[model samples]
Target chain A: MIGRLNHVAIAVPDLGAAAERYRSAFGATVTGPDALPEHGVTVMFIELPNTKIELLAPLGADSPIAAFLARNPAGGMHHVCYEVDDILAARDRLLATGARVLGTGEPKTGAHGRPVLFLHPKDFDGTLIELEEVA
Target chain B: MIGRLNHVAIAVPDLGAAAERYRSAFGATVTGPDALPEHGVTVMFIELPNTKIELLAPLGADSPIAAFLARNPAGGMHHVCYEVDDILAARDRLLATGARVLGTGEPKTGAHGRPVLFLHPKDFDGTLIELEEVA
Candidate 1:
């Protein structure tokens, strides 16, 4: 079951500028400067009360983040994440309900070394949703 | 500093159906059957730990939810909120940055008697953002 919101991902054309803007806007402190090679982008997170605002910028033209930016030039909000206790159980239920799971099985490490899984946007009414388990 | 994400609002075509689907998928419990007349919509919140999934359906065509649904028929995610310590201070700083505030002063009351205010979508790159003080 979904536990709590984990983070909201935003695709930015430039991660540095976006991070600076948020820090200036909310006095948010930076958590990390990390990259997920599989996703082909770099990310920075600003930790908040129950979640964080993650900024993603593509490392190359072939990156998914690049494609997302090409479709949304204004850099709109990208996805919402929910924390779950059991990733596999949640995946099973979502799959049973016809929700498209991005992967075939259990989750691997995601941003910040946390286990994560993504539900396809098509299955979630056009909003890409991610499920993460921190503990 | 901002700590964690509070909630993300999604404007739906039908609240009852959306709520039902969510319940069936995750076994989530319904937390509210309330209305925010000021926002012109009847909302149902499905509480999940640190946040809740708020389903908003317009009470009338003039309601913002109606307009949002009219623009996006497939349904889409609406907003992201951050829980803050001082609403007034946050408002003051946001104003200083030239962000457009929907309400001129401190938050009055929102969906569930929680103090709330909205930042115009234009200022936040086309995503309507709401700030709520849940504590």
Candidate 2:
């Protein structure tokens, strides 16, 4: 059901600063620091060899990332994302195994125009996991 | 200073059950699932492309993973790990950038024959991050 690790999401207070830190420390370059209006967060992705490190900062109070940051004031790790070959098949399997899907609707295009879906933290044992099918 | 993603650490209450669930859902095989006496927990790894999903369950009260599980009972997501080429250098640079290193000691071999080091959640803003230099 899962392919590679698409990306690892980190919630930051400032995206530009985090991206600069990553670049200076690891020689990683930001791929896309695009603003996800629907998700209400601005995401900056630093491309690594096998996986990308995502820097997420909440745009406002209504954004999920902001809510997460509020809950974790120190702003530690955020979420784990897995690359799935078939989003629908993976979702169905997760559901069959009693995992709760965050969205009852279809998977949508995410930060990089990839088809993405989320499994609620409740079903996955408090982890907000994302399943993305990279095009 | 990194290799491929060694594994993702997820804090769970029941290692056995979660492992079973993963096998059932993704046809994945657990690699280690071994207990790290020093870390005070048992870890089960589900291998996938470019990364491994780690299921971390506490063996006793003193385990860090157990503490994490306690804080987040619903058991959502845990931490993100990056494959680093040199654990020592990575640690040094991160410290230089005002990032806190969890251990002031040398990198040690983990569940597998991999050298692993952890960055403090304080430095990364509430995220417990790990760096592994895989052999």
Candidate 3:
């Protein structure tokens, strides 16, 4: 079952500009522009009291967010991650509900280097969802 | 300055179906169908451990989310609300940075009955952001 609301990911056209914008305008604690080449994106976190806003920029041609950026050139909210216990069990539950999971339906190393899986956007009311195993 | 992430608002086409999908698929604590006719939308909350996921649907023809829904028929992330210490000050800071605020540059009562202002998505890396004044 879902537990905490992990982070909201936004794909941005410019990572540094986006990070700087938050830091200067919102006075948020901006951290990282960590590039995850394997994930094909560079990320920065705007740390908040209760949650985080993740800024993502495509790292390569095959980057998962590349297509999204192509669709929304200015970038946009990509997905929302939710913390879940027992990743396998959660996948099973989602499958039982006839919802489709992305990729091989297997958890992969996410930006946090934790097991994570993405659910099909169509099944989730047109919102992409990522479930990360927390415990 | 920004504090907590008040909530992530997702505009859905069907409030009931979206709430039910989350409750049944994600095992989330879903609440409401609270119609804010004044705001021209109905809402529901998926209570999470640290924050909330707000599900919204258009209430009438003049609904703010109607255009958003028209573009994204199924649903999509509408805007993210961040808590601010003093919204007027926050607006001034954002304006000083040349960031544009939506509406008449005035804070209005938000769905939570708090003074809030929306920032232009173009000025925010293509993401609509709401700043709510929180004590």
Candidate 4:
């Protein structure tokens, strides 16, 4: 159902500092500070040879990352994304197995401009799993 | 520097059920209920095409997973492991940047029989990071 590991998303109180850490410490290529109003996050991508790291900061008061930061003031690992060949098919298959998909059960444009959906953390042994459709 | 995502570790109260979920739901190849007494955890790996998912359960009363399960009852994402070319060099680089490596700042033999070290969650924006020296 899941393909390659797309990226790991981290919620950070200070996105710039987190990006700098990856840049200076690992010499990673950092890109974007793009505001994703629909997702309520301002994101940056730290690219690596195999996978990418996403740094997310709250974009508004109701941002999910803001709530996460409130619980863990320093920010933390928010989610892990995996690529799927067909997200809708994956969703349907998962749903058939009693998995809960987050949001309106519809795929939305993700940071990579690909369709993505989040699965309920409780259903995935407490890990928030994101499924992104591979283009 | 990180090479690839080695695995995403999830702390589960019941490793068998979690492993079964992946096996039955996604038809993933699942292996191990191996007990790592040194780490105080019993672990299983759900092998995906690209990356693996590690399901962790407490091996003893002193197990870290026991503590995590105490707080989260339902289990959750514990840590993310990334591969590195050189363990010592990565350690020195991370330390020079004031990153706190967990435990004794030395690599321990991990599940994959590789030298691995954990970074402090607090220092890493609340994300527990594991760096494994790939063979």
Task: Give the per-residue lDDT digits (tens) of candidate 3, residues B81-128.
Answer: 999989999999999999999999999999999999999999987899
lDDT for position B84 in model 3: 92
Cα lDDT listed for each candidate: 0.75, 0.75, 0.92, 0.85
Return the clash pairs for model 3, or none. none
How does the DockQ of candidate 4 come out? 0.66
Candidate 4 lDDT at A95 equals 90
Best by TM-score: 3
What is the C-alpha DockQ of each candidate?
0.56, 0.60, 0.89, 0.66
Give the higher-TM-score candidate: 1 or 3: 3
TM-score: the better of candidates 1 and 2 = 2
What is the C-alpha local distance difference test score of candidate 3? 0.92
Order candidates by DockQ, high to low.
Answer: 3, 4, 2, 1
lDDT of 1 by residue, A13-121 (tens): 7677667767776788866568777778888887776667787777755786676788777677888888888888888898898777786667978766788888887
Q: Which structure is stronger by lDDT: 1 or 3?
A: 3
C-alpha root-mean-square deviation, each candidate: 2.6, 2.3, 0.7, 1.7
- Cα shift from native, residue B72, model 2 (Å): 2.0
**TM-score (0 to 1) for chain A, all models?**
0.86, 0.86, 0.98, 0.92
Q: What is the fnat of model 4 with respect to the true interface contacts?
A: 0.64
Model 4 agreement with the true structure over B1-135: per-residue lDDT tens digits: 668878888898788889887766566789998989988999999877778888999886688677778998998888988889999999999999888998899999988788999998877788898999986
DockQ of 3: 0.89
Q: List the residue pairs that clash in candidate 4.
A: none
Q: Best by DockQ, which number?
A: 3
Over the stretch A7-124, how does candidate 2's per-residue lDDT look in tens digits?
7788888777777767776667776678778778888887777787788888755887776777776666677777788888887888788877786648988777888888777666
What TM-score results for chain B when candidate 2 is compared with the true chain B? 0.82
Using all chains and alpha carbons, the TM-scores for the candidates as numbered come to 0.86, 0.88, 0.99, 0.93
Tens-place lDDT per residue, model 1, B43-115, is 8887878766777777755787776778777567888777777777887888887777895666968765778
